[model samples]
Target: MSRQHLASALILLAISVALLGALQLALVLPGSDVPAVLALFTIAACVYAAAGIFAWWRRPTNAMGMLITLGGFALLIAGLGNATVAPLEIVGAVFSTAIFAVIVHLLLAFPSGRLDSPSAAATVIGGYVVALPLQLPFVFASADSREFAVASTTQRIAGAAIMISAAAILTNRLVRAQPRTRRILLPLYSYGVIAVLAVPATSLVFTTLGVRGGVAMPVIQLIVLTGVPLAFTAGVLSGSFARTGEIIQLSEWLGASDSRRGPLTAALAHTLGDSSVQLAFRLDKSDSYVDEHGTPVKLHSDTRHRGQVAITTNEREIAVIGYDTQLTARDEDVRRAGQVVAIAIDRTRLANELIAAQRDVVASRARLVDAADQERFRIAQNLHDGIQVQLVLLALEAQQLANASDTPRNVSTRATELRKRIDAAAGDLRRLVHDVVPLALLQRGLVAAVEDLVDRMPIPTDLVTEHENPALTSTVENTAYFVIAEALANTVKHSGATSASVRIDSNPERVFLEVKDNGRGGAVAGKRGLGGLADRVDALGGHFSIDSVPANGTRLIVELPCG
Candidate 1:
């Protein structure tokens, strides 16, 4: 228990002792009814005080504890009226009427310990004004042997009026409360209605019979006060059981492995018995909150609504749970439910990330296949447009040279030019074939093929390879070769580079390729031909990245899974 709760317990204990001492003094006084009335009041005060302590210990945040404790303390103050000493009687007479006001306040604020509505607050204020302040005149009049009849009559009328108004407000609240709240408060409301009616009924009975200080008065008051404490305890227990059941049901519903946010939100709403409950997840990357569908959500509060509670895990906020204003009284319950759902929210978020990664992989593979088909088409067109036309022209020139027999020397010179043309056509065909699939790559190995490519480049290029080159699958070798070729081509054409280097390293599990250049570099992975290269690497289940800054130079890295 906290120091606050311990202090409250001690205060209640002191009040109990004071009430007992006063009741003992009353029992010794010379009166036939003194002992019975004092005993009845003592029993009622003890019950209320004990109930209040229980509530305080169980739920310190609730105001119901303070209200109940105040009600019991007020009873103790009223008990001082039964003391044998003259000074005690005067002091008790001044404050005894205030007990009725405390009772009215307790009834209006049952369970929540708050006067939630304007009408309820007004009723409580009126009860205090009539019971405590207005009754002062009657207290002085009775003590001085002055005209007290009118004052006494006026106090009774005002007290009855306040009790009737409180009953009406409580009845309305009970009728309008949410179904779940109404169920938990039904017992307290029922007892409150009886207590309210008892006050007026006791007054009417005594006035009709013209009787005072009768045995029936204390008996009736005992029954009424006894019901108040019992009703409060019943309400507290019922609410506890209801919350436990809700938590259990929520756990069972969430047990199934569901990764979707919609079902989780629905289950939480149903368990909380609030249809308006909303769930928002925080996107850590974006520093914003989003709904289940990925749309951003804004949290706002107005007079009729409260703000949201941030649900956290490991001190990092992952989600927010929003509820209605009516449900604010049960904030403790809402927080408990939020803690339970935080874990599930984390799991669902991870599952969503995995699904998104899988979709990107599928899309990247499709693009890679499409790019390969396009490259093949371009190769076919290049052969038809460049090398095929040159070969046809070379054949025609040869035929013309053979047909011209009159000018033998001219024929020999023309034939010599035709021989040079044939040599150029053959070289063009060889380069095209190398571009498609290097013969050295298939026969000698990847390193030899890359060396051949470096020799053909227009600018200075270096080739570095690990001595132990583990044989990779054909697909991996082809992809790596093309990736290097594309990077070097981009460097020579776009990066105004003076020199470049290609490095290849391989182990049992993967092959690593790096291309670096001392060039004015601003390479972007998603632009130019690099995007296609990235897709091809992804298709081979590899990783590709580029680091390029203007005036600094560029570095392209590719890792292909060779195992």
Candidate 2:
């Protein structure tokens, strides 16, 4: 049990024992009927005190909650004793008053009000110190009428003063704290009011029956009988208090929510009360967040902008932005959904950043590749312009020298070797230029350029197209031509294919190209040369797929977006 609760239980146990003993002694010892009535009041008091103690044992965090319950029990016992057949005499009343004093001390012992604030602590302790001593006058009241009046007034003042001040302390405690406790403790307030009134009602009913003593005893018995089972039931279900606490939290968040504008704002504007909620996060660290009032403040300087549900994550504060259109305080399931909004927002931000970065990197790399291709084309042009022309001129000069000279075998042999060298160097230069950039592709466009490639191949090849397209941008033509060229090269080098067909087709949305070879088809896109070509097509935001079976010929299909 918690310290506060344990103290309450101890106080209740003492009171129960003293009251039960006084009832037996007062009844058996032949005292006046008033003593017996007071004893009955003591029994009623014990019953209610026991109920409060049991509730405290079940939920210890609610010190004020238990104290409120205990106070109600004390009143039930005292009132019922006064109205019952077994009323307490002077001695029994004194014992009961001492017991009541202990209960008061237990209430004061609670670290309520502002435990951290010395002034709050002093005010709570001072109230108890002033009120506790007044129990003495009520216990020691003489039977004489004037002395009795003084005692009654003192008792009334003491009871009123302690109860009122404790209530004030508890109210302050709740207000300064967060809102969760209020929600959790709401049911307690309801049950307490009902239970407190039950005893007085019971006393009234018994009083109408013309009982010898005051109506206090039987009334208290009824309260105990009813309240014990109820307290036990509440204890059994007290785990729900945690959930109730969360409901209070949700209400607070709703009151403070601000989603005046965003991409979601327009769609959500009319969607605000009966649709599935979708939450998104923005890295929104403006000077201040806008509120319903349209005014702004430095968000860093104001706690209100800290969001309805703010938490520090990785040492950075983030707010959960809620977005469910149907979300409300009355929804029970939402109460347990802890910090989900914050998590959702963080995930969205991370996903968006990743997507943007991927796009940027792909674009950058494509630009670099284009620049490198242009540089190679320039170098190839230079070789074809400068070195190949010069070599051809030299070959012509050597042939002329052979024709003019009479040095028989030597001149003829020199001319033959010169012609061979020139031919070989020219062939090498032409292949180098083609590898750098297909000049036919640059000049003629995709269909004619690919047809030129097929005509040049040693093996028989068919160029097929449903609809011929005009010259595309240099980049698209280059990428498409090379993909077909590489597939054919692979067929020639390794596929041992007898025949190959290249197909080209296009419409408004995209351009489609396919190459199929009647080879021993085991061409894997990654394992074969298709991998590099596939990467090129993908860089253009297109699709590239290779379908090949072990014995079946391979088909390569590619699509490029038409803009």
Candidate 3:
């Protein structure tokens, strides 16, 4: 509780304690009749005071508790009407029935402690005006005067109308309430309505019993009125227990979930009954928190739209949950909610962190793959422009030497053989460069690259393309190119395939490739090339598979998405 609420509670506590002792003075006062009246009155007033204090202390942000407190104190002030002293009797008479006005206000406000509509507010104001200001004239005049009697009748009728309005307000609230709220508010408001209407109910009971004044009415009224506060106290207890139950259910629900941010966040929202609540995790590698989707989120007071409650366990901040600030006014209660669900929050946080870490690792692998591709391209460029030119020049020099008029036949034969060897070497180097990094795959697209590859293969290879996107992502292009190349290489090297078919298709989401070879196959994924290819595919949030049986053809499938 805040210091202000604490102070208010302390003052109320002192007054409640004092009222217990004041009951003895009421016993000896004039018009006390018997000790039973003081006992019942004091007990009923104490119930109100105690229930009000409990409500106020539990929810200091609400005014219902203090309102009930006022009603209880007002009831005590009204008891002074039993005194014979003129000053005391006048003071008591001023507030005697005024307790009903305060209760009317309390009932109109119901559990929220604020009149939701103008009509309810006006009704409460009217009740207070009729109970105190209008009744003042009657209290100051002679008890048997015609004017006082008319004022008394008017006050009762006004009180009755105000009571009916408060009851209608409650009924409207109950009808419009959501299931969760209505379930708790039903029994709570029922007791309050009964306590309000019971004053007349007890008078009717007296009329039926044919008794004018006795011990029976006071005792029955006390019992009936006492249930109001006790009902409030019971509602408070049930609400507390309900919160506890929700917290327990939170843990159990999180245990069965995938432990991702969305499910975990939704579980907390359901527990708190606040759909706008969001969970952001404090990742070890990040300076700021990220939401369930691993997107960076700024925890600020921008727009003042939500309140953030930090959940820390073992002195380390796990996460911060943002909720509707107006609904959850108590920061302390929000803190307690975080504490209760700390384990679930931390579990989802770790899961998100692990996912982020895995993504980073995949990105690192992709970077390395790109680096390797660049290095191979550089090597191919060097060989094509530098060594290949040098080999051509040497071959030209050998041709010139062989064709010389004075050249020996043996030397010319050797020169001819040297030219042939150089030409063959040059051809091999070109093929090697082409395999290292194909120009079609880099500059054109996957379809063109596969076509080039199919044309170069010694065995007959069929190529199919569907919805091929020339603007495919570089990551998808590189990974898809290499994976298909590896699978084909494996098929040729091990499967003894006669012919192969390659089908490449594309959509907005991803590129799909399938390579199938009609040959005796016995390819294993873990052997060498497929293992690394599998990791590469998975890292990019794609799929990869290789199928090879002893008598069946080998088939390789790969899917790659840029995002």
TM-score of each: 0.44, 0.42, 0.56
Write model 2 residue lDDT over 289-376, tens digit each, in one string: 3222222222332333222233335655433334332233323333133243344334445555455556667667667657766887
Q: lDDT at 25 for candidate 3?
A: 57
> Which pairs, if any, clash in model 3?
none
Tell me the number of clashing residue pairs for each predicted model: 0, 20, 0
Q: What lDDT, from 0 to 1, does candidate 1 have?
A: 0.73
Best by TM-score: 3
Ranking by lDDT: 3, 1, 2
Q: How far is candidate 3 from the true structure (C-alpha RMSD, Å)?
A: 15.8
CA lDDT, every prediction? 0.73, 0.55, 0.75
CA lDDT for candidate 2: 0.55
Best by lDDT: 3
Residues 1-563, candidate 3, lDDT per residue (tens digit)?
Answer: 44365768658685754664386355334455677776667667777887888776655545667777777788777776666678877878898667777767776765556676899989989988987888797777888998888888988888878878877888887899778878877777777778776777889978998989778787877788767766765564356433443454565565564544346677677656566777889997557788877767877666476788889999999898888776566556567777877886787688788888788887887777667767878898999899989999999999999999999999999999999999999999887877777878878877788787788777888988885475665766877888878877876787788899999888788788999998887777894688988877887778988787778988888888755
